[model samples]
Target: MTPLLRNIVANYTSQLYVILIGLAVVPQYIKYMGIEAYGVIGFFAMLQSWMSLLDLGLSPTLGREASKLKAGVTRAGVLKLFLRFLETLFSFTALVVVALSWILGPWIASSWLKLESLSPSDVALCVVLVACIISLRLLSGIYRGGLLGMERQVVANVIAVIAATLKSLAVLPLLIWVTHSILAFFLFQLVGAIVEIVLMRIAFVKALPSVATEKFQWNLLREPLRFGVGLAFLSGVWIVISQSDKLILSHILSMQNFGEFMLATSVAWGAYSLISPLQQAVLPRLVVFFEQNQHDKFVLLYRQTTMLMAAILAGVAGTMAAYPEHVLFAWTGNLTVAARAADILRWYVSGSGFMALAGMAYVLQHARGDVRMHIRGNLLNVFILIPSTIALTLKFGAIGAAITWAVTNLFFLIFWTRIVHKKFLPEIANSWLTRDISPALLVGALLCVAAHQLNWPVSSRLLSFAGLAVLVVATTGFLLFIQAETRRIMSFFLRGIVKILCTKNV
Candidate 1:
């Protein structure tokens, strides 16, 4: 297989593995750790998202520079120097993160989280450990970006799988056999983060060409920093827009209720995971195509990948949104938990579906190195989303926040994508929506709705899960079959198989 295709497959494999493992283990985590403790784990996840704001866009900028290096638009030595500067900058920032976490941990445990069973002191310690783990993982992003930009995705994925296995699966044994202390969970994750960063650093250095006398230059920051600053602003706004509901709800709800909300959110996030692998695999190639002025190739890749993403994301999201109670019940085997989280999950997954589609436009802008429009769009979104989220969440609780989430992303997908296409890719804009995206979306949604109406007899959790799996497969197949490109490819393969059979008969 070609490198790009191989990279995409490898990325999908790694992501699927990680996601499946997490899915399999989460119910166990809630069972063993208790719902309140799981809330702390969810809090840890939110903290990591918040901490990414500290990156200030350097990681993605570095990834772009690495892509330039591979295209020979940048020299190896220059890329090495830039990498060192970012390393130093991130290191100092990590220190600040730790210090702030130390100060804020106690306050969050005491004031922010409405804890019932867990000790404040123990939760506070877990918060500190969360900071340490997040910091180390943040440092790993630098190397991870470099690897991806260089298109060494196989190596990057290998490291990711290893780290995920250790951090996720290994923790189960520790929790089961060693101790159920939440602090122990975070401690194990801290060790995994350390191992991950060390592996990433070594792999990144090895991937670089042998260059003598590489030295960091402070002046080199000027060009990339301009791009980084725009991205940083965009990233900050995005985090606030996306995480505001969670942050608000964290204080508003008790820890148990928050955990239930988080459960729904986590499942909803699987929609993004469906699209993320393709986005990552295509981004470096998109950058290379743009740099080389391959506009035709760039547009083709963008549309094709967008359609594929639509097929996968729509099927999963539509199924979950259409049958939220069925999905939650099948996965968690707790009808009460399923009932509690289902309404929230429905809207969240629907929102995530639109958000994932809108992300394609964002990737288009990112490849072209112009995020000014994206920044403005996000700024507007934040302004509207924050107040609305607060009002809705307070008035309606988790469901209110979820409705706002779905509506905001739907608005962004409808309007922002047009604005982006008008500027960067006007030629394909109409076709992109009418042909590339709309077909799969329509088919997937209709299939899901039909399946839900059928009301298949899913008497047990096992049968319910089987029913959902069949629905997903049928939806995906129909969506792909309706797409012209995928249909053409399928016809070619079928013709080849028929020819082989005729030759054997002759």
Candidate 2:
């Protein structure tokens, strides 16, 4: 198959399988663990979010560098160099994380949280699992990054499918037997991690074209790593910003509250994960276009992508905010927790939609090799994201904390746009601001106001959801009709679909 076809299949299949498992396991987690237990689970997940730093940005850098030499370079040589750098950097970072988790897990539980319900041992068990999972994650990065750089989504997706399926399906039955303690839960996950790595290795071997090691360019390691380290710092800070809210809550609020807050945030981020398949499929291709200095083409595609992302996020976020009870109850069967978090969902999903814009902007910066600017933008987020989170958590509880998280992105988006102009394709980036972004934010705000007001007078879940559907459809239709740019993008995307179909038929 062609590379484009291959990437699409891989992204779709992998994301689909993962989503499948997520659907099965998440409800079980909610039912069995309760909101407080899920909160602990969320905290562990965030702690491992630090592993993004381990790759720095080398995975993409590896893919870009490797792609430039595709027909020209030796695969084995490229693979070897990629491994050497990734292992060294990952090992160092992973050690620090494990050490801190070992050292600090108890202190955090006893001193920071000071909850009688949670003992030092409880936090320690979570930390240990986190460290193991972090190591497995780094290894997966090496394999997946190499595959992605090689644009071997077909193989990567299979591995993702297997791992996600196992995690989502296999664990449920086992959890039934071992659901007594946190250690058993972590053990089940740790074993799943091992199974995932083994599957990923087999997939990589099968997908790769067998190239010998004769063309080893050990020297490429030096400069490529320099780029990778920059990615590490920038991506690391971003990791902290996106995932730290839960961890911060674990620190400030009780673990129980943190879990509920984290659940709401995870539900909001669903659109991001759903849309990510498209982003992953296209990203490596963007590098090739960037290498060709096709700035106009890149900007054109970005504009179209922005509109599609906005449409999907708006529709989904609107439905979610409008019928939080309907959706969350269906998904997880926990109406009490879902009801408590209804207002927070309205803002978090909208904020996540905005965050998605910032993330795409970051990806553009990555393509341009604008590392310093990327680093600067993320560093600024730490200052804004952390303080806002603490202040809001104290005053507003979970809902306030989420709004603070969202507002920080609004702040970061302003700086990110400026740097895009100064550093990347200035001309296209300039018009990009209002053209692609404004529709979603403008319409979403109007929708949120309508959703919030509808919470009353209906006095019932079923009627409230009906009101939400009306508001969402009306808002979306209004945008499609009035916004010329939104229409243009939808038209272009649909046309591409038609062209692909015609080519297949012919």
Candidate 3:
């Protein structure tokens, strides 16, 4: 297989493994740790998202630069110098992250979070550990971006699979056999973070082309600094748009309720997770295409990947949104939790699907080395979303916040995406909406409605899950079959299989 296709497959495999393992283990975490403790874990996750703001857009910049290096637009020595500069910058930032975490942990545990069963002291310690783990992982992103930029995705994904397995699965034994304490969970994560960084650093250094006398150059920062600053602003706004609801709800809802909300959000986030592998694998190639002035090829790749992503996301999101109670119960095996989270899950999954589709615009912009449109769009999103989220969460609790989430993303998908296409690639904008995105979404939505109407007899959790899985698969297959390119590929594969069968009979 070609490197790009291979990278895409590897990334999808690695990401799917992480998602499946995480899905499998989360209910067990709630069962063993209790919902209140799980709330703390959720808090840690939010903090991680917030901490990404500290990256200052350097990680993505590194990835882009690495891609440039591979395309012969950038020299290996300069790439090495750039990596050194980021590494050094991150070292100081890591110290600051640890210090801030220590300073804020006490306040958050005492005042910010409404804790019930867990001790404030233990929670504070876990918060500190969370900081350490995030800082290490933040450092690791420098290397991870470099590897991805170089298109060494197989190596990167293998490391990711190993790290994800340890982080998600290994923690189970530790929590069950060693201790159920939240502190123990964070400690295990801290160790995994350390190991991940070490592996990433070694791999990145090996991937770097051999260059003698690599020296840090201060002037080299000027070019990426402009791009990185725009991205940093974009990142900050994105965090606010995405996390403000969760942040507001954490304070407004009870700890147990917040945990349930988080449970729903996690499942909803699978929509984005499903699309992210394609994004990562596509970005470098997009950059290369743009650099080579292959505009037709670039648009073709963008439309094709966007279609595939939309199809899969529609299938997953429609099924989950349509039958959230069954989805939650099948996954968690808790009727009470399922009932509590079902409405929230439905709305959040819909929002996540739209957000993932809207994200394609950002990828297109990023590949072209301009994101001012994205920045402006997100700035507007932040101003509107933050106040609305607070008002909704306070007025209607989790369900209200969930509704706002869905509406905001849909608005961006419709309006902002159109604006982006008008400016960048106006030729295909209407066709993109009509042909690329609409078909899969309409079909998937109809299938969801039909399935719900059928009222399949899912008498048990296993049956509910199996039935949902089949529906999703069928919807995905139908969507794919409707697409001309995918249909042709599927036909070729089927004909090959038929020929093999006939030969065997003869």
Candidate 4:
């Protein structure tokens, strides 16, 4: 199997386990927390994401550099060198997070508008929880960084699944024990982070034999900071683009509404969490293939990944779009929050699919050491996005913000595709240039639009519409993505199911 295919297998395996287990308990947690409480969870999660903003982007860069070194060198020596350097760099990043949190933690809860309904004590609790969670995450990144640096996505995925499973299983019970109690949630997070740290250390040792020694290399920091800090800034900017909305919205809108936006954003982002591990898995393979000059293999794997992601997102998007309000209620069970979430989810899906492809392109750029171009596009995006989001949201609310996000991302994708083609894939570049994927995207969007047009009963009788919505989504998505190869895969699966059914009958 190619690197992409291998990575996909690893990612899918871990994701399957995580999804089935993690998703099983998430809804219960949400129900227990209520939309507002859940929104608080979302806010802290964003802070965690933000704290990760400074990750050296050196994860993939390290993998690329190591992959090149691996071609002719001993892994043991190289791994130690790489780890020593990373340790030094992350020490600084962690210190920065600590100082920043100490300075800003108390203020975060005060300015956020959504917390008006929440007691000052509760908001204070959330902020403290977020600060601790952020600090824990910085430490966790060390192990994750090693996995990515070694192109050990399978290992990275294993760690993620374990962490997610632990997190999901813990959330509901704790919420039940202490309803919306931020201290309780903070303690749960502290415990979970410890579990993740131990698991990650174990996983890193077993999965990537690069560094098993418990050695410190503090002096190695200066070199990595010199070479890697620029990349870290680029990564931080990208995170800001993806996550700053909540902080910004908190400033512009009330924190309660921001809480609603936070919920919608969380649900919208969950779909990606399911998909990104796959992308992370595929990337190292792409880098290896490019290094090998096996362009055809790389392109084929890229194509396969794109089709599968699009198909899955289309099905997911269509289902939510069809009975958005219904699924919203069932998923979170808070109608007011659900309504807001449904709109964001529906608008966000198209962008998710669009970005998935562009994300691949960006990953490819990173693998090729072309971060400058990616940085260029991000710079353009911020200028276009911040003003638009601020202005549109002021006029049109969350839906308007979602639309701005989607449209700006489309432009960003176009810009990246142009550069990638001009620099790399001249032959297939035209497809991206002309927006050929637009047709497939249209099919998914149209299904969502059709469902909205139908305007079915969104009341207590929503299950009836839910069934119809699921059916419509499944049917449309299948027709859109059921290429010849996918059909063959389906046939094989169906045959197995049939054989089992017949054996049972006999």
lDDT per prediction? Answer: 0.87, 0.68, 0.87, 0.64
Which pairs, if any, clash in model 3?
Answer: none
Residue 79 in model 3: lDDT = 80
For model 3, residues 1-506, the per-residue Cα lDDT tens digits are: 45777788799999999898889998889988999988888878987998899899989999999998877897888887888778888899889888988998899999989998899999888878988888898899999999998899889999998888888888999888878898989898888888899999999999988885357666776798788999999989988888888888788777888899999999999767989888999999999999989999999889888888887887889888888988989988998888889999999999999899989999999999999999999988988788888898889988999999999998988888989999999998778777888887787578657766876543589989988899789878888788986676457657766787999999
Estimated TM-score for each candidate: 0.95, 0.84, 0.96, 0.84
Worst 10-residue lDDT window, candidate 4? 69-78
Tell me which residue pairs clash in candidate 1.
Answer: none
Query: What are the root-mean-square deviations of the candidates from the true structure over C-alphas?
Result: 3.1, 3.9, 2.6, 4.3
lDDT score for residue 333 of model 3: 92
| Candidate 1 residue-wise lDDT, 170-230, digit = tens | 9999889888888898898898899999999999999999986366666766788898999
Relative to the unseen true structure, what is the Cα RMSD of model 3? Answer: 2.6
Clashing pairs in 4: 113-255, 114-255, 114-256
Error of 2 at 442 (Å): 2.8
lDDT of 2 by residue, 188-294 (tens): 77887888787766665565556654444657576677777787787778777776666666777667777777767777877567667767666766666777777
Please identify which of the two predictions, 2 or 4, would achieve the higher TM-score against the true structure: 2
Clash counts per candidate, in order, are 0, 4, 0, 3
Q: Can you give the lDDT of residue 437 in candidate 1?
A: 78
Positional deviation of residue 168's Cα in model 4 after best superposition, in angstroms: 2.5
| Candidate 3 TM-score to native | 0.96
On a 0 to 1 TM-score scale, where does candidate 4 land against the true structure?
Answer: 0.84
